[model samples]
Target chain A: MMIRLHRSPSSSMARLIGQPDLCSVSNWTSRENQLHNRSSRATEQLVALCKWLEMRMTKLIAGTTISLDGFTADAKGSPAALYADFAELQQSEAMQHAYRTTGAVIMGRRSFDMAEDPDSYAEDYEFRTPLIIVTAKPPAKHPKEGNGVSIIFATSGVADAVRQAKQAAGDRDVTCVGGGMLIQSLLRESLVDELQIDIAPVILGSGLRLFENVDQRKLKLTSATSLAGGRTSLVYEPL
Target chain B: MMIRLHRSPSSSMARLIGQPDLCSVSNWTSRENQLHNRSSRATEQLVALCKWLEMRMTKLIAGTTISLDGFTADAKGSPAALYADFAELQQSEAMQHAYRTTGAVIMGRRSFDMAEDPDSYAEDYEFRTPLIIVTAKPPAKHPKEGNGVSIIFATSGVADAVRQAKQAAGDRDVTCVGGGMLIQSLLRESLVDELQIDIAPVILGSGLRLFENVDQRKLKLTSATSLAGGRTSLVYEPL
Candidate 1:
């Protein structure tokens, strides 16, 4: 039987299914009708599908690492004061992959201090990613505009800050770049959704820890990637 | 000037000091001299003391709030889940303060089915006070026994189950408690440190909430309190 078409020939769906002689057109029309029927019949199911995709799409995480001891700073309050250098780890392919995939970076006041040039780091970061400085202090007036980053001094709350950052990132990722204090603060607030740690080969016998004074909780390793140079990267999705 | 050596014959220190002054005590004379010096220093410091007193400590926080959208379930499965039930919040508080002060409680598998729990919550919950749970499914299982209340179940991953439940309970108090997944798998992986929650006021609309498929990184209130009525409660925590 010929399938009657509603639209013009330019509508490929209409022309392809309107031919009278070909069983191909008949089968195509039937399939289209079946799809339409199913969509209408299972509206709830379709909504669920949309929701599932939306959740997956809208999902974003800020990943960072700190020492086991939970100290993002040293006794003098320098974030880089605690650890040896991360030069080797930073140069790895995994680090590059993470940087490329992430749309933006989330940082706290203490973490921001570690960047050699807070302003320049925010401005000319190699990745060209957006920078979000999560701080309780009021934002300083930008010395100039289009520094390639927008500084947000989030005093109101962490959740609110993340929400704003996520929106800014659109459909990309947010990487939490720093040591323990900011991460710990976020952890204390339950704001960080995922944690990815690159366990370096050497351990500092005594220095600022990654999670000092942090509440006790559990972390499950969702993915573990072992790098060539005795380095291991672990990805954990909060339970 | 040489201080007068005299025994009041009252206090232990005076008596001992005088004995050391005696020549017959020469065998242990050095020890007695050391004791006498220490006693004299104590007396001098006591007399020099300006003030001595005890004080209670209270850390100040800006404030926090956690709201349960109709996502969590009650015993029944319903969309209109309990957002804030003051009664439940009180129960959670009581569970922490009365039952377990220093230990942990477990959560179940179905409890945290949405998102993974973050480490931020865990560090906050477990630093001084610890909670723990067990589970096998999406939501984490609540931990029972040891040093806290029993388990509640939410089927989820090991790390998140422990992290979220702990963070949901902020500074007020908490103990580790989760259902099957948290305990069975997370516990084995050592992700959970404690469990605590603040039940809220109002009844759930209907359904198996409290543990459902939630976002892996969602957290509501950190603290909750019981109200005048036995049934109503409030759960609020910084997000």
Candidate 2:
């Protein structure tokens, strides 16, 4: 179902959340209407806002492999260990459909530097979409590559990086690629809208946690499907 | 799907995970063959194992209200806030069916002590089932009460509490009530079979974490469904 955000922030609960600072919710939040307290009165606005955001913003949706313990990667930052469980999911039609909705990819600098393998840019991976890297020292701004994918670096931060990626995505969605820390920053800043995670059924006793130190926020599950090969695909909106 | 534990631990990747500490796999592990690497070879084992446990183990499941941030309660340990989101879910048929499967209820000392209401021991909540509590100090070693639910205390740790609870449960499942610390111990000890958390779509920015300081382990999701009143019911088995 397409979720829309209700802008009726007139309830006392709405008033409680309408502080100027919070009122100035990011374009990501304002566009996606990701604010939700889910309390009796507050939940109404949340539901309304969720509906609005669902339609307004080019959703910053993320597709990643997350372990049951909620780690996106191992302690050494390698993603292959746990993510390999969903190799088939990465190549599935559902995944292809998800990627087809993406106009651009936003990722941390580390992911940018590490995404050198030609196969990693396959249609199964990201379809050679335009890439915007959130970095302190972005590499030389390159226009579209031979694959027709534009690669740009945003030295500014998450918001600016997302803005550029959103513009680049046109009417499609922006995919946030991760390296944990940067993902945490985007989530903390509430720049993300939907999370499409393929949960691998393996546990690495310890690793860089997927939701590490990210601010506490409740998510409304839009869908949870048991995919082929034991991987679980979960789609959620931050309420 | 009936998940069976495929005992093909001969994969090179399986060898990587077949270490001695993990190999002293509990009778629970051996009985259920609770192990999975999720490599091409072992992923089959994980799939099989997840199904087996789902069917075999009269799981010691937890049915608690948790916030989106993975907290079971507030920092002060009060669970009134986010938990209220599931007032309707508590009265759900799904919840009632889940409770009907309960043979016993295991909880921490705090919960036992704080459960001053007569209704907490009701057929709906615990159905006056056998209540096994883990604590250093055993309250009075009471037998079955007038409510037909036996109330017992285990001064020992998680294993003993689970063992006793299992014995009392016989053919039924055990419900572990959470206060965070004890549940962490159970999860850390790898004694918990299934977690049925009703995630309230609300954020408590600061509170005691649901799985605070617990060991990191991947959980295989058995099922996830949106319950009544917007709460999401998630059932997972920790690997």
lDDT of 2 by residue, A1-239 (tens): 23344423223433454434444434545434544332345655665554344335577886677665456777777777665555576688787887777778888878767857523453334556788878898555443364647667798878888878877775577888677677778778887788776666665556666665666676777876776655666677876
Name the regions of candidate 1 deviating beyond 4 angstroms: A1-62, A67-85, A143-148, B1-239
Tens digit per residue, CA lDDT, model 2, B1-239: 22334323223333454433444434544435534332434655655554334334556786677665456676677777775555575678876886687878898888777766533554434465788888898654443365657677788778888878877875577888776777778777777778776666655656776655665566677776776544666677765
Worst 10 residues of 1 chain A by lDDT: A1-10
DockQ of 2: 0.23
TM-score of 1: 0.37
Q: What are the chain B TM-scores of all models?
A: 0.27, 0.70
The CAPRI category of model 1 is: incorrect
Query: B160-226, model 1: which lDDT tens digit per residue?
Result: 5444444433323233343322333432443422222322222222333232221111122233233
> Model 1, residue A74: what's the lDDT?
38
